[model samples]
Target chain A: MTASASERLTLVARPLDRQVASLSALAIVLALVDAALPTPLPGVKPGLANIVTLLALYRLGFAAAVWVSLLRVLGAALLMGSMLTPGFFLSLAGALSSLMLLAPASRLSRRLFGPVSLSLIAAYGHIGGQLLLARLWLIPSDGILYFVPAFALAALITGTVNGLLAARLLRRWPSSKH
Target chain B: MRLIRPGDVAVFTLAALTCGLVVWACWTQSPARTLSIRQGGALWREVSLLHNARYHVAGPLGDTVVRVEDGRARIESDPSPRQYCVGQGWLEHAGQSAICLPNATSITLEGARAYDSLSF
Candidate 1:
């Protein structure tokens, strides 16, 4: 039995790790695509890469989702040449906050919440974290808070769209419960 | 499986409430009719945006010119390096502002439609 269990871990873990890497790669590509779009204001992006993270959280669980998110943020930051810069720090803050918010959310109501609510929560957490970091480290002024309305609106719209997309993807997920 | 679960509906309702509240707060702002200039972190002067006038204020680096025309304020000229202040162009919106870090001078629109908040 021990031997079989060990074999099971080896076989299943390998495939899962490969799946995480592939998802991370897809998220990285999305991030690069988002970067190519022109933003009318700073800190405004569709954040499409988060869809992969949401999928990972639902399918592969929290740790795998975290790994995918970090890999995407790091890989994309490196590719965009923003590593170790303020932009990287902001992205890192946003990703970490979303992961933190998603952890308990997934456990609380896996059957009820679904992807839409989870996506909305994570999206708000992400933008809130980035804005807080920008206020504290990047610009030391209350003047920046004026943009919260715009940012909040953007977050709501993008979160809903991303959530819908995630829900669709979740519906199409293979039925054989992994 | 359904596209949206009961929980998704609840979340959507809550999100909608939050968005509506934000929109109301943002749009319900007083219109601005005055322009305030600050130097060295102090209130240097306040000018009426209703009148088309130009004022030259002494800045840390040199003289900076602020112009108000047709209910809009803008930094017409500045002797600061990099010309960043001048690039800000016209400030017709309530929360719009221009700052010259080198000269430590800033022009911010004020009055009825003043900002409920400012983004850094």
Candidate 2:
């Protein structure tokens, strides 16, 4: 006997729901880690949550990836108690801009450079957005300069880590689960 | 994936170059010997520096005191709980600034004869 159309839809929907729930869980965990970790630089973050972003990009489409990214930023901000401050706005700008750049780049180059490359590109975009906001709004003068090196370093480290992790996940799960 | 894109390289280089320029500009600015302290949007005290010029800044959180001497500057404030600005040293250049978040205070050093006094 052949399965009905609605049955197949339900099958697909269940996996999608599971995937979204897992992604949300990953985001919350990363946010907690970010707040708890100790770093030498003030206002500098490791952005470990980006690994989830890479996973979402590989498994889901750009829309799903974007949703994950936005939810991560907003949820992290709320959890960190920086939701309404200038820092929150700055982070929001950076996260959105990075996602905007990463979504397109991931679609274009997901096959060649794969996860690692996409992660680096996204991290770079994140730093770029932060620097732009710092120059344009926060400090407005030389503030961009102060953050450039630190941001660059962060992009390199976080991108590489997230990229490698994503690559590992993709290798382990070749077929998209959701 | 790629080593770096041309645009990314260009932008990064530009940012680095701009930082160098700002550091240079800040280094060349004049030293200030007087400091003005403010609290709650009102001027609190203006102190004149003598020998040593080492200042201990204590005030309500986010209050700023700008100390200018010769072409140098030192800022003390309560800015937020991080206290990143308090840890910063003096600034004696056109593009150098120290901000205290807890105190909502900022100190910038401007060159005496520079074209842009308002640059920082």
Candidate 3:
């Protein structure tokens, strides 16, 4: 019985490890791609990698999704040589805020708030977190607040695009019903 | 049966409302012609937009000649290597500004505050 239990444990662990690994790798690649894309303003990106997080959230579970996001933030920071820098902190803050929003949002009935709404909320949370951090540590002036309108507008555009894409992808996702 | 659900519509409406509010804030806020000259982060002078005159302000590098004309101000000349501030031409709008980095002189057009300040 013990031997069989260990075997089952390994079976479950292997697939879970693989899922986390692939999801993290995919998110990292998307993050690097987003970095390569030209942006109109500093701290603005398409956040394409977030699609992977949303997928993991909707299909796999919130825990898996959080792991993917945390790994992606750490991995992207390491790859970009911004580890332990302000940039790393900003990414970490954004990812945490995204997860914070997603946690509560996940409890809502699936029919009323689907992937699109959740994704949009996560996106806004991400931007708002980074902005708050930047204000507290970097600028600390009313001048920095002036960029709120521009940043908010960017967040809305990017959030909508990401949310719609996530929604479409989730529809085709095999186990999305979970 | 709709691909776009009610949630999607709600999100879109919320985003549109926020954008509209931002646009309204920008549009309704009048451009204040109050121009302030600063040197090394200190306020050197405040020139009223009601009057049009030329004034010389001392800066880190040397002197900057500022001219206020018809509710607009410009750095007519500066001692900087490149007359970049002069090249900026004019500062007519409330949010416009011209800076001579080398000379450590800046002219900014400031208006009334839209809000008290953004809270963390």
* lDDT per residue as tens, model 2, B1-120: 333334444444454464465555444434444445444446555555433353445556523445555546676444567768667766544445566655655554443443333443
Pick out the ten consecutive residues of candidate 1 chain A with the lowest summed lDDT.
A1-10
- State in Å the error of residue A108, model 3: 1.7
Q: Indicate whether candidate 2 or candidate 3 has the larger lDDT.
A: 3
lDDT against the true structure, each candidate: 0.85, 0.65, 0.83
- Cα lDDT tens digits, model 3, A1-178, are 3465445443456676688889999999999999899988878899998989998888789999999999999999989999999988998999999899899988887777777777778888888899889889977864675577777788788888888888888777677343
Candidate topping DockQ: 1
Residue-level lDDT for B119 in candidate 3: 34
Tell me the deviation in Å of residue A130 in model 3.
0.5
The predicted structure with the larger lDDT, 1 or 2, is 1
Candidate 3 achieves a global lDDT of: 0.83
The CAPRI quality class of candidate 3 comes to: incorrect
Better of 1 and 3 by lDDT: 1
Q: Which numbered prediction scores highest in lDDT against the true structure?
A: 1
The regions of model 3 sitting more than 4 angstroms off are: A1-12, A176-178, B23-120
- Please write out the lDDT profile of model 3 over residues B1-120, one tens digit for every residue: 234678777977797688678756655555565999988888999989879999898877888999999889999999999899999898766767888889888888877643332233
Q: In every candidate, how many clashes are there?
A: 13, 29, 0
DockQ of every model listed? 0.38, 0.04, 0.23
